[model samples]
Target chain A: MNLRTLLEEKKSSIVKKWVHVIFEQYPPDSTNFFLTQKDRFLNPVGHAISEGARDIFNALVDDSEPEKFYPLLNDIIKIKAVQDFSPSVAISFLFLLKKVIRVEAGAEIARRNLTPELEALESRIDQLILLSFDIYSKFRERIFEIKNDEFRRMTFRLLQRANLICEIEGEKTTPGEETVITNK
Target chain B: MAVQKPEELSKVVYTFPSTPWMDTPVEIKKGIFCWGNKEKSLKAVGFPNPRQWSVTDEDWKLPDNWKEIFIEGLRERVDKYRSFRLFLDICVRCGACADKCHFYIGGGDPKNMPVLRAELLRSIYRKYCTTSGKIMGKVAGARELTTSVIKELWYYAYQCTECRRCSLFCPYGIDTAEITILIRELVNLLGLNIEWIAGPVANCWKTGNHMGLLPHTIIDIVSEFKEAIYQVTGLKVDLSYNRKGAEILFVHPSGEYFDPNGNVTFMGYMMLFHEIGLDVTLSTYSSEGGNFGFFTSNEMAKRLHSKIYAEAKRLKVKWILGGECGHMWRVWHQYHNTWFGPVDYLEEPVSPITGTKFENAKSNKIVHITEFTADLIRHGKLNLDPKRNDKYVVTFHDSCNTSRAMGLFEEPRYIIKNVCNNFYEMPPQTIRENTFCCGSGSGLNASENMELRLRGALPRGNAVRHVRDKFGVNTLANICQIDRATLQTLVDYWAKGVAVRGVHELVGNALVMKGEKERTTDLRGDPLPGKEGE
Candidate 1:
C-alpha cells in the first residue's frame, strides 16, 4: 500500500514512457527513424533525447542533490534549445515528466490514498520545469550570440588582412565586441 | 475512473519544428552559421578573406576579378589533383550519401548532406568543365555560380567534418572529403577561412605548434609533467629534450603539451618510454605531429608536415616514433611521401624493447605509438596489471581519420584491451570506418558555431549515450587531440558521467613503473583502483 515504493519501483517503465513521448515530438518522417533505429549512430537525436530523459528521471527519482542534477538537466535542454523548437516547446519535455509519472503511476497513487504525497511529487516537477526554463533560455540566448559573432568574422579578417585601416576595442572579445572596424 | 482521454494519451507533435531544407534554396542569414577564419591567420597563410565581408550581407564584397580567380583556382586544382577532377565528373547523383553525413542527419539541412555539399562545387564544375553544361545550363544539374551559391558553399563546406563516411557507400567510391578540401582551397583564393583552422596553420608555420605557445613555454609544460611523474613514481623519470643523435625522435600532436587530457597522454608516453628504458628525444622544432595546414590545403599541410622529417634528420635519430593522434596518422600512412617524401635519410623504425622490425612502417621510417606498444605487449614486454584501471568502463572511439584514411583499426584496441579490464565498442555502424567525427574536425571547432558543432556531434554523442546506458561505459578512449578537446563537451552535454581519454593514457595508468612508490593515484591524480581508500 506504500505509494512511494510503488513510484520508485516503476521508475524504468515511467522513464520509457517519457522517452516515447519525446521521440514523438520529432518530425512525422523522422518518427519512424527515432523509434526503429535503436543503434545510437543511426539515430543519434532520438538516442540523445531518450538517454537525456532517462538521466533527468533517475536524478529526480533518487532525489539527487541540485549540484549533481542541474548539469544533467542542462545537458538535455541545451540540445533542444538550439534545435527548431521555441523556448516553451524546447523545455516542454520537463513538463512531460509530470504527465509520464501521473499516467504511469496514477492508479497506484489513488488506490493507496496518496494524493498529498503525489502532490508533493507534482510540485517537485513544477520546480524542475521552472529550472528548465532558465536553462533553455540561457542556451537559446547563447545560440543568438554565436550567430551574431560567427558571421562577424568577415570584418576583422578582411580589414586586417587587406591592410585596410582599422581599430580594435581590446584583447579578449567581450560580448557585442568587434576586433576591427574598416575606414570605408 | 480517472482513465486519460485517447487524444491526450497519444503523442502530441508540436508545430513550428525546425524542418530539413529539402531542395529549398539556402537563405543567406545571420541566424544561420558561417564561421569566419581570423585575419592575421588569413594574412599569415596568404589567403583572401583580407577585405572584411559579412556572410549575412547580401554582398560578399567579391572583387571584380572573382570570376577569373574561380576559373583559375578550379583549373589549377583539376590539373593537379586527379581525385578532384574525377569526383567532379563521376557522380551519378544516386544520392547514396544523401543521408550519410553526420551534419545532414543532425542539422536537418539537406545541403549539409555529403551529396549536396559536393554538388555545390560539382554544379559549378559541370557548368565550367562539361560540354553538355554549356548547351543545357541549369537543366543538366548545373547551376550558375552566383554569390548566393558561393555563400551557400561557405556555410555548408565548414559544416562538413570531412569524415569521409559518404565515400564508402558511393557506387563509384567518390570521396566528398576531397571535394571539401578542394573547395576549401578555392575559397582561400578569395581569402575566406574560419579562424579555428587558419589560426592554427599560421601558428604552426611560425611557432612550430598550433596554440602559438613559444618554445620556452613548451619546455615549461614538460617540466610541470616531470613534477607529476616525481610525485607519482617517487623516482624522477629521465625526461629527455631535443637530444641530437638519439635512437628515436618522438613527435606528438602539439595539443598534448597543454590540453588537460592530452597532458595525461603526454605523461603516459613519458612513463612508458621510461619503463621500457627506450632512448628517445622529444622535438621542440617539430613539436606538432598532426598538420592543421592539412585542413587548409594540400600545400599548407605538406609545408607543416615537412618539419618532422627535417627534425628527425637534424636529430640524426635511428627512427621516428609518433604519438597517439588521428590526422597525423592519416598524413603519415596515406599522404606523407606524396606530400614530403623521399625520406631516405633515417633507418626503418624498430622497437628496441620488443625487437619488432615494424614492417608496416619500414618504408616510411615512422612507427605509430599504438603499433609499437601493441608489439611490446605481443612480446610480453609490459608488466601490466589490468586491474589498475578497474574503475573505468572503457570504450574505444575509432577516430575517423585513422579508421578511414589509414585502416588502423586493431592496434589501438589491442593496447586498450591489455590495459583496461572493461572495454565496450559503440554500435557497429558508429565505429571503425563508419565512425562519426567529434563534430569539430576540419577547423569547425569554433566556440561561435557551437550550434553547428553540437548538431554535428549529436550522432557521435548518441552512440556514447547508448553504451553509457547499456553497458555502463564511462570512459571514451581515442587517439585524437580534437576529440579530446571537443568530446569533453560532447560527453558532458549528451552523456554525463562518461569521461574522454587517449588510449595511451589508459596504458600509462596500468604501467607498473620500476622503483616506483606505492602509488595512490593514477595520472590526472585520480585514485588508483585498489588505492581508493588511501
Candidate 2:
C-alpha cells in the first residue's frame, strides 16, 4: 500500500482541487501554514498522511513488526485527545487519504490498498480527538470545575501539541520509539 | 520550594511632590485637580510598603458623590455596547495562555495568572448577567461582587499589560485583556479607580495628555531635540506643531514630551519622515498617543480615540501615524477601525514610497510609525548609514501587543538589521510573540505604586541583564515608546549601564537627512565628527 505512488498516478487536477478545498477548510495560521505549504507534499491531507505512513513504513522496514507500529499510533491518538481534534475530522482525514490514493494510484490499489491498515489508525485518532474534546468541553462547561490552575494548563498544552501534530502530519505519530529504515 | 513569608518581601516607598496637589484651586473639588489631605492619605495607603494582601482601613475614602458618579459612568458605557455576546460567549479558559505571561513567570504570583485574573471578571459577569449564573449562583460557583472584590479587581486589572499573548494560545481565540478592560471600566463606574491613574486620566482630558505638560512645553522639548538634530546632522528640519495642511499627523505618548530618551525617538521619527520627504505635523491638542481610557472603560477609549481622529480631521491630513507605544497600537490595531469609522477622507494607506498596501491595518486609514518605517526600508526607498550605530551592540524587544496581538514580528527586526550593525536577538523564547512586558506597561508605571512597578519590572530587568552579560550588549532597542520609557527606569534601577532606545532613533541617527550634520544625532556617544570609528 504505497499511498505516495497511488497519489502520483491520479489526475493532478482532482488532487489539486481537493488539496485546495482542504486548505481552504483549515486555512493555516502563522504556526501551521509552513508545515503543509513548504513541504514536498503541498496538499495538507496528503502531506499529513504520507508523513504518518512514511514514519510507520520506515519503522516496519527497519524490521520492527506491526505490533510496534500499532501502539505507537495509539500513543499519537492519545495526544490528539489533548488537541481537541474531532473524531469526525480524523475520519474525514482518512477519507481524504482514500480519495488521494484513488486519484493517484488508480482503482486496484484503492480497493486492496492502505484502507485496512489505516482503519485502526483512523479509529485511534478518532478516539484520541474525542477524549481530548470531552476533557476540553467538560473543563469549559463550568468555571468552578477549574479546581486548580494546573489542570487547565496541562490540558491546554495537550491541545496545543495535538493541534500542531494534526496540522503537520495529518495524523498523530506514536508516543514511544518506532523503528526507522533509511533508504540510504 | 518553600513559600516566602509576606514579611520577607522587600518594602520600598514612593513619595510624590506635594506642591502640585497643594496648589489645586478649591473650585475643582470632585475630580483629580482637587486637593486632598496628602500626608494623611499617603500614610493611610502605606505608599512604599508592600501592599497588604487583605483590604484594610487604608483604602482611601472617596466622597459620597464619587460612587454615584462612577456608577453613572459605568452605566453609560454599558448602554453604549450593542452586544455583550462576544464577551460572554468566547473564552474557554484552557490556560494555554499561562506560560505566555511575563508577569506570571516573573512573579510566580498565582493572582498574576491570566486565567485566574480573567476569572475575576467572568465570575462577576456570571453572577449578575447570565441566566445560568443567576439560577445556579454558588452551585455554579459564581461569586457575589462586593467592595472587596472590586478592590481585588482594581489590583489585578492594573497588573495585565493587556498584551493579548494569551489570545494566541486560545482555541476559540479569546482576548483576556478585553475582559480586564471591561472590569476596570465597571470598577471606574463605581468611582473606585486608583487615584494615581484617575489623576493622569483627568490630566489627559484637560491638557490633551496624561503628563499635564502644556503645549508650549511640548514645543520647547521638540525645539531642544531640533537643536540636537541640528548639531548632529546639520539638517534644519522644522519640527512643526499644530500646523494645518500637513499631509500626515503624528501622535505619541505624553512621556515623549518629557524624557530625553523618549524625545530622542520623537526626533528620530521626525528626521526619518523629513528625509523621506513626508509632509507631517504634530498636534498639541491630541499630542499624547496613549489612551488611558483603554485602561478605564470603552467610553473613555472611544473618547480618547475620537480626539486623535478629530485632530487629524482638523489638520486635514490624509493619514495619521502613531508613535511607539504598546497599548496604543493594540487599541489602534484592534479596535480603532470599528470605533472610529466612516473615515472617508483618508485613502487606505499604500505607502507612497513602498507601493505595499497596508491592508491588514485595523483601519487601512492610520499607520503605526514602526510599520511605516519598516515598509519604507523594505521598499529600498530609505538609504541608511549603519556605520553610525557601531558604538553599541543592539537587540530588539518586540512590544507584546504589537508582536502577539497584531503579528508584527519581522518588520521591526528587518528595520533593526538595516539600521544597525551587530543587531542581535534576545534568547528565542523572549523575542517576538513570546516577548516579556517592561513592568510598567498597562498603567502599572503609576508614580504611586513604585514598589509594585519595581517588583513587576524585575523580570524584564533580569532578561536585559542576562543579554548584556552574555552578549556584551550595551543597548536595548524597541519600537514601543512605553517599553523604552519603562525600561529606562528599570535599567537605571536594576541593570545599570544598559540604555534603552527606540528602533527609529537608531534609524534616524543612521539616516543621512538633508542637513546631515545639523539635524541628526550621532550614532556614537558623542556627536563629534572624528569620533565615528573610535
User: Which structure among the candidates has the greatest TM-score?
Assistant: 1
B12-131: candidate 1 lDDT, tens digit per residue: 544325554333567643323645665677788676647666565677778788777887889888988888899999888897787678876675555776887888888888788788
Quote the TM-score that chain A achieves in each candidate.
0.81, 0.34
lDDT for each candidate structure: 0.77, 0.59
Docking class of 1: incorrect
lDDT by residue for model 2 (B1-534), tens = 112345533321111112321121111111111121133222332222222222234454544464454445444544565344465456666667754555554333445567767776666666666677789986654666555565567667777768776666777666777777877766554445554455566677778887777887777667767776776776677767888988778888887755556767877887887788777788888978887767766767777678888888888887877888878877877787787655777767667666777776535477887789888887788888887787768878888888876777887788888988887777666668866677667766544344345445554665666678788888989877678756765565545678788887888777866545543236323542346343
Q: Give me the displacement of residue B252 in model 2, in angstroms.
A: 2.1
DockQ of each: 0.14, 0.01
Runs of candidate 2 with Cα error greater than 4 angstroms are A1-184, B1-93, B131-136, B352-357, B361-364, B492-495, B518-534
- In the range A91-122, model 1's lDDT, one tens digit per residue, is 77877777888899888888888888878777
